[model samples]
Target: MTSGSLHRLTAFTTTANGGNPAGVWIGETLPAPEIMQRIAAEVGFSETAFVAPAIGLERTVRYYSSEAEVSFCGHATIATGVVLGESVGDGLYRLTTTVGTVPVAVRKRDGNYEASLTSVEPKHTAAPEALVTEALTALGWRREELDGAIPPARAYAGAWHLVLAVAEAQRLANLNYDFEALKTLMLRDGLTTLQLVWRESATVFHSRNPFPVGGVVEDPATGAAAAALGGYLRAEKLITTPTTILIRQGEAMGRPSRINVDIPSSGGIVVTGQAVWI
Candidate 1:
């Protein structure tokens, strides 16, 4: 963090302003937790990923919000990959996170660098009844407003998120909620974001993320959540295995982002998208 120089990148979009933006900080070693949080607050993105690669097999990578530390971040990982590709040359870069070692593959795609990360083994669990009730209460929605197609589940790829599927797209758009209440509940439950989604079809889905826990009201494009959704859908047999699905996000906020998810049999889900400088 010397010289106060911070590098920024827009992940999940080939062109600038098309995907969620993230700040990437590459330093000799990770800054103090408080210092990283301060830098992230100044960077003012949904999430900032800091990478401090260790020698040999592990690379320590940490994610931070404007207010605190996060388990993992998808866009920031992609952004960090691109930055690593540019500086270290394109190849596989291993990021040792608080959870595990995350491998990111960076390559030149159509003249612009693209980074795709393989998440730590994903895990999903049933959403708690009390948390669901509190979330529904905060969102001003009732039980009937939810979609039966995708039941409530707390899914995790590299992070934990509660998935709530609404039956209609409009429900996903009108996102006014009690920020403090949701944040309190999320903090208590160790939630990263609430994956609010609408299933348009078997292959196409639209989503919104309520991220009060991150000190942000909403997340425009959420790669980690998308990966979690892919795993949840496959685990529940909601979608067939070896399926490629499209997740359209950020449209409600006007920064439309598209994430291509590939669910393979017996492996971590692969989420691919392009990013540009913003």
Candidate 2:
């Protein structure tokens, strides 16, 4: 596979320069693991998606960060959906990922394409106290800086994430962390990202993700993290009703992104966003 065969897109935002940039490769067959890894590293994006275009509505997809393969990736899935929509047709595509089967819906809106992905079954568990302590230490944040209401959790939809809610939005914005330390912690605990967030309102949140494990200091927009957060809230009973919430991420990095998460009483969490060509 060559770089020319890849499609560069930014997900979760319509702006040409905003959102998480991902490399989407659509071909007759998936690339070899080594080739995909090399392509991802060369693309230099947080994540690159390798997809075998669907026969009918089912497509085989794989997600790789610059350094390793991820079981699932939301932004890359959305970007692929838009690509498929433009190349195939606007509708639904069932993506078979390493983790599980995910269904992505695509449509054209306002001259740009939008995609919504339904994650696999969502679940969460209490984060290990030791892990939380070590993570806070790496982040240089005091225990009191965390939001008591939301608490800390190891949330999982397609991938595992440590969800930490900050008491104030400003604390979430000041993101200076020991990258090596955090990366070590995340690798040991098998966490994809540290979802540091502040609840702006009952249904609105501001977030920043530290993704050193992916060889990136920060992910401008993280779809898996948003799905995990929605699952975390629903599991913890923080969300009492079936509603839609807004997650505003990447703003602190100057690459603003918007993710819409719809939580139901049960089942998969729906994460929606728009991707555009960069």
Candidate 3:
């Protein structure tokens, strides 16, 4: 229950300057829920992860944002995986999250540690017309700017997200929105973040995640959202299965991050990124 138990790290970084910062707390037993919330708020990251021992290579994990506890968080999970790899050996570790059980593999590649987590079963549903209109209004976006090929959807892969695809990259780059308005809408609809994206190519995409629910303006690297996006694409038959796609995020925020997603024919999506000790 002390600050000394907390470890600060950055995930999905290509360099030290890039990536999303997260606090990882590894303890023999988790602290009380209120204590965890206080620690996460003090850390003030988009999300903080708490880890405790389970069976053999399994661990019980919890995620909390500055505002509240999250069902799942990808960047924080990656940060925790790297920390575990350093303490224990590099291998596969099972994480029991609030949403479901996720399996993360940690390994050292080219003298750097990397982690990949397989998401829970992902599902996507058409967003309600009224909700979409409200979200666009809050974001200061017009309906015409949307990409017709990719419709707006409510996607879930451990966490919920509103997936909005814009027609142009510049549209995605200009991310100025009413924080309070968007936060209110997200909270009402149980959305964790707004997955605003622009497609650069068939296999490449650029994304920005607005995480007002987490008490943060944006998330630099959002693994859970990325997994939901992958599932959405697959379920909609927008992409061929058994393919790998790359997502570039946080460029506008000046902390560039890279996320690699491997989509299989069935089952969970695989999200990969690197973490560094801060």
Candidate 4:
């Protein structure tokens, strides 16, 4: 029989009602992949993190959505870090994900735990005109509505994401798209999520992510995408180096999540957020 203790927590929001919820399963040893998949489906959250060797500072972590296994999940990692901190005291925890090793620093702030996870080396590639057109068609977005300043690109921190920046906030608010069409396009393009965003200011942004591939309509908070955005901006020279950006997500969906991204001159991007018990 499978064995693990499951904890439910929401990431990027302090309140119990906000943020993206995830299931954290801690066990001395990981169960079979099939069993983990079943547990993820049963959890019914956007993602569930399976952490093995529950008693150590360094552990192996795997992420699974309701549909399939994901290479990496930012919010789930944040939740896992807090869970580990509560159980093993506050410190740095190392997680070995399928993509690479991620170091997460955990600390108690305002009587609640917060985690900062440094992603694997981030990179980006230009999105071809044809690919951008197809993605826009799937999302029912017109090419003119896009921000010409921020060209479409495939950005990756741990998982690949299509970073599309719209020119207006209203366009992002009315997010209506064909779920199946977007899912098919994402699968074909090998995208984990579409980072649909609107630049509110020089260092502030608002975003919405369509995650049909993960069997979810939309993600309230997407940390991996946030980190990818930071890397994309730095790599593409869209913003000044060694700056921090704040991403406000889930507001359109009523969850109101906040993700803080710290970008250095080089190396991995750091994604920081808070998680609360659900």
Error of 3 at 138 (Å): 0.4
Best by lDDT: 4
Residue 33 local lDDT, model 3: 90
Query: For all the candidates, what are their Cα RMSDs to the real structure?
Result: 1.8, 1.4, 1.3, 0.7
Query: Against the unseen true structure, what C-alpha lDDT does each candidate score?
Result: 0.86, 0.91, 0.93, 0.94
For candidate 2, lDDT tens digit of each residue in 214-273? 999999899999999998898878987598999999998999999999999899999999
TM-score of each: 0.95, 0.97, 0.98, 0.99
Higher-ranked by lDDT: 2 or 4: 4
- Best candidate, TM-score: 4
Writing each residue's lDDT as its tens digit, candidate 1 over 122-175 gives 889989899999999999988888999899999999999999999988888798
> In candidate 1, residue 169 scores what lDDT?
82
What does the lDDT come to for candidate 3?
Answer: 0.93
Query: Per-residue lDDT for 107-214 in model 4, tens only?
Result: 999998899999999999999888898889989999999999999999999999999999998999999998999999899989999999999999999999999999
User: What would you estimate as the lDDT of candidate 2?
Assistant: 0.91
Q: Please write out the lDDT profile of model 3 over residues 14-61, one tens digit for every residue.
A: 577899999999887888999999999999899999998522578899
lDDT at position 274, candidate 4:
91
TM-score of 3: 0.98
